[model samples]
Target: MSNGNNRQVIRAEIKYPILAIVVLAAIFAFTSFALGYDQGQLFSIVVGDRAYEENFLHELFHDTRHALGFPCH
Candidate 1:
């Protein structure tokens, strides 16, 4: 019963790859742009130039943009 060697091994089960981090960062940046700086640009892709004139997104995020300190005017 007098053994001098006893050891325990530990392993981590979670892993984060560079690709996952990059994808998350991209999503965050896109969301920020949409909510803070979007002036109908995103909707313009589907609705054409009219989106800019309508300024739907701008109005939708207007109060939020101001609260978050984004220049809407």
Candidate 2:
């Protein structure tokens, strides 16, 4: 009795061709640009959260307060 249960299975494979390379490269470049752009939006959202608290201009207020050595309550 021969059981072929234990065998190496290739989960994924890329075909070798000029068009394949071009298509993959285009996708990679597009994804890079899209991710970078989206990351900028994400950063702005996080910064905005930090920049506003208790009805204050939290970001600018921080700089001015620290520069003038004003007490932070």
Candidate 2 C-alpha lDDT tens digits along 1-73: 6598878878887669999889999999865443332323333455764333432333435555556665544
In the range 1-73, model 1's lDDT, one tens digit per residue, is 7585776679979989999999999999999999999888999999999999999988998999999999889
User: Which runs in model 2 stand beyond 4 Å of their true positions?
Assistant: 1-15, 38-73
**Can you give the lDDT of residue 51 in candidate 1?**
95
- What TM-score does each of the candidates earn? 0.75, 0.31
Worst 10 residues of 2 by lDDT: 34-43
Residue 54, model 1: lDDT of 96
Candidate 1: minimum summed lDDT over ten consecutive residues — where?
A: 1-10
